[model samples]
Target: MNTTYYMSYKLSLIASLAGLLYGFDSAVVSGAISHLSNYFSLDAAGTGWAVSSVVLGFMIGAFSGQFIAQSLGRKKALLATGALVFVAGIFTAIPYNFTMFIVFRIIGGIGVGLGSATAPVYIGEISAQKIRGKTLGFYQMMIALGILLVYLVNALVASWIPDSQWGTDYAWRYMLGAMAIPGCLFMGLALFLPESPRWLIDKNRDDEAKSVLTRINGAGYDCQTEITAIKKSFQAPAGAQAQSESLFSRKYRRVSLIVLTMALLANLCGINAVLYYGNVLFENMGIASARTAYYQQVIIGIAFFAAATWAVVNIEKYGRRRLLIIGSFICFVAITLLGALIWVGIASLWMLVLMVVYILFFGGTIGPILWIIIPELSPNRIRGKLMSWATFLIWTGSFIVSQTFPMLTDSVWLNHLFNGSFPFFLYGLFCLLWFLLNLFFVTETSNKSLEQISAEMSQA
Candidate 1:
């Protein structure tokens, strides 16, 4: 008999590692950007392009992620992403000019895009309803873990070569390229994991799907009952194929808009702005030196990871929407205070404290909840495609904010008027708006099965 003890958690944890790689690849550049910019002779705009070009690749991978997940199966899709990350990391590390570096960074971003889109769906499908919220939240926890880990790595790697020697040495390359280790781990574990049983059932491989489900659910569990629910989720009007349930259709218009808006707003709150360009922002805000910036970042990373873990532990108990609301209010206060502090020229230490507050609230509430909510809300039949689109919108928001942040901050005219605090004020407003959006439209999905969520959403 197949053992179910800890199997579901074990599998979800493996899939969640993709989030770790996503975090690693995405945030690794922050540590290396200053040196890389100097090495490549990039101005602010060029630096923005260098940093954001990978997001373009993220959009591409997100756009195509559903097709791959659906056709190739979730396990294989992740396997491919792992390979892409591994290869990209290796090439990005090799001593190369800016052109080659950007190329490989984009490739790595594709892996991130694919992994971001698929991991939640894979975990949502594989995990039991009893632990679904926690399971899905684990992906976000891993993302936070990855970011925290990379920050520590960046600090260590940056110290290896002094600023004077960094340009000539391989330090920057090592910072960006260190992501290859986790990418390889993601791929290796994915090799041992089973496919999303729901995905297999979708492909008509029922027996194999049953076998996988039994391993996850215990031999005595009624795998057929869950199988029936999966099949029933695809039930639609006469002659309607599941894939044709386009998000733009009348059936999904509200949910689609919610997904897109939330995706965009989620990124617009300026989290990436901080993570990708922390050094630059802190310097602009009157921080002392690059070393100081690294220390602050390590602190921020620790707070973020701790908060994400807190969220993962509590999401199932507190309910998703409630946390977001609480998070939204605190995030608004923290971010607004952060901006005002910068605007009024408060002490850098005070500003750092406020920034940590904002990150803690955001990580605990909004960041992890969305990862769970998006997949839970999608209809089972077109789950992958909707997830793909959501991923696209997510990266789109990330790319826009990430690309424009440098330009906005570096703008002489804007900086002159706002004292280099314009972007934070803008982000604060967006955070408040997100609070309203959630209050009016978002529904609670805590402690519910995917099927229940789909049905509830369809009726809503």
Candidate 2:
């Protein structure tokens, strides 16, 4: 391969490792949390808190990531995040008590949150607009890969230890500790990639920006032209920064609202709730064996993996808005069927089939596509901060849905009102609302550069 192509490929690989860290953080706990709950002799609410604590830490870190990116530059911020996660992973595995375990999980969560926000922003900033969407798909693909890796790893670990030992005290520690090796690898790789040129230019290091851009783009492109375009985007008219306050600022109200709505749409389709709580959901539905539930959950991870891989390859061709519209409708139908099957007292097998279909729809369309839209919609100057705030909201939505699912399902009052299908019905409602929102407000971004998209949005 050509030297420039080789460098670019390596850089993309390193940046995408952050996504792998993200995926591991998400999937590892699903296997370990159950054992931890039993070891601590915890109740349902305590178990939920143990599971959702990382999400809360993620919200805090995401909220903090914007300022860190703006002040530190993408490369430095990512390195710091990786290092923190490395330590967090160690802390997570060695905790001797419940409080210590929760504390370490929170720390690890900070790493996940920061890496999730920074990796895509780094990939988006460094890549040429022509291939930017595809580059970001690598980030999402690794996230799916990481999820798959953790599930397989957890299964192997669980098999080696007797069932009595799994919850006796050590299984949870081993599950969390296994992450340290990957976490360390991510940190080492991050050290090799260059800082984002757009961030360098924002720091007024024009010569350095030119050097980095040249390395990524090769000898044929005009560095001056690229720099000028970035400068224009970065330095808007007077009071423009005020207009770009956030997804809620009056100046950015339309774009902000669209981004927030999409983030909510992504989470409320109930994918995380399903992933985090799937084993229990299966058991509750009368899948008699523990091993059977775990094996089924692994199948869910495979479905997620396949869908994300397909998305990474097809996202740019299909476009973000189109996928959202189509995916929302598909999810609506799936959830509607899922609820109907339960409400009508269908075979348990049918519900499992619907769950797989739901996973397929969410992973293929919404999971990968939501991140694609989030970064693309923001102007370069504010992209990091806006993405951070938006991610904060997404993590918050995850926390809410994951925490509330059990209560919604078990509440006698809600059961009386919704007749044992409240979670499905509520998610179905979210899916329908998401579809309408997309039809009315979201814009087509296919074939447009980020610069062009921003220009169009500004004109509007």
Candidate 3:
């Protein structure tokens, strides 16, 4: 209700638009994949490649995001990413061949990778410690909104075009290209936003950093104390030079390992495989027809959006590690049940209900918390580098899942073992594993200052 809180929310919300672009760009492909397969005469491998190519680009962009964010500043890096998204969107809609389509998809994916890496880091740097978790959760909320919006767009476009033209023509094009509208909005608005105050402090622009921090933290807040704490975080120990150290150096080894493992675990839990192939999976389960699958996706998206909103509200209240462990257990149960239902040839409505449950658990827990926790775990001096590395790992995991889900399900040996639902069963096992990992290894970071977290990591 405070005026300064509103200002902070406005800024954080604007930056979070990058998440929306990432979500829309990523999910739009879900609706287009079946059409693409028909249009290109794709086999399982080709279909997988078409769907997962963006993740390949995501890996590349994430790998390079640190350099871009450090060199050009986070705002500029995001603006460039937005431009790339717009270009990729336009080209993707009109690609002359499958190869060209893949290229454009990769390009858009690079933008997604960059935005994903930078936006949360930017938001984390600007946010007050008390509200940081919810603020970062806002980025995940935007991602959910983007997915929901794309599903609606896909449904509308598919309905407008005749069924005969669905596989061969313009409907998919419109869906892929509609991403450009948000891309442009992100670029234009990013230009007006300030650079990260922490980043400015790192660059020794103390006056400017103080100005920005004062504005965001409001008139009553002690800007100097916050700034001092930030400065203290960057100070090195007796023999160590903070700026000279790599993220993988002995000092950061523990924190780096935690973030890298968390990132991999987040994607390997099979979130993207579900998001990217929900329509096909639903049809495979006999829950809906291909035409009806688009509408079903709208339902899935709504579930995801609502769950993410719940996460944003309750993340600080419940603590990150607790929610992740609980959510992972829920996901494990839901996915295992789903696999069981399929194996037994039970095509009841429970299958649909379980899918929604799985999504709710995922979106509320790992989906948003992964982003929130990573930023909190890393020290400001290496935050960009560490986040980029973690995101790279995340996308690598995503690429593996998105590219192999079809193959895993279609595997002759696995099919023999689990009646063609092997992948979901395997993912369910992963959820259980992740739950245990979080229980044993993950730390509670809710309501902690970044400086306090950095100190804790350093001590550990």
Candidate 2 C-alpha lDDT tens digits along 1-460: 4455566666877898888887888778887867877888877778787888888878878888998888988887788778877887898888878898788778888888888788888888887776677777778778888888888877777777775765557877877888887889988888888999988998999999999988888877699998999898877578667666455555566777778777766677677767887777777777535556668878888988898889877888888778888888888888888888767656578788888888887888778777777888876756887899888888888888877776777788977777667798888888898889888988887667788777766554
Q: lDDT of each prediction vs. the true structure?
A: 0.86, 0.79, 0.89
Q: Give per-residue CA lDDT, model 1, range 63-158, as digits (tens).
A: 889988888989988998899999998998884577888899899889888888889999999998878898899999999999999999988886
Using lDDT as the measure, name the better of candidate 1 and candidate 3: 3
Is candidate 2 or 3 superior in lDDT?
Answer: 3
Q: How accurate is candidate 2 locally (lDDT)?
A: 0.79
Task: Provide C-alpha RMSD values for all models, in order.
Answer: 1.9, 2.0, 1.4
TM-score computed on alpha carbons, candidate 1: 0.97
Each model's number of backbone clashes? 0, 1, 0
**Model 1 residue 35 lDDT?**
81
lDDT of 1 at 429: 93
Instruction: Give the 10-residue window scoring lowest on summed lDDT in candidate 2.
Output: 243-252
Best by lDDT: 3
True-vs-predicted CA distance for residue 460, candidate 3, Å: 4.0
Query: Tens digits of per-residue lDDT for model 3 on 186-242?
Result: 999999889899888888889999888878877777888888889999888767785
Model 3 CA lDDT for position 346? 90
Evaluated against the true structure, the overall lDDT of model 1 is: 0.86
Reference-based TM-score of each model? 0.97, 0.95, 0.97
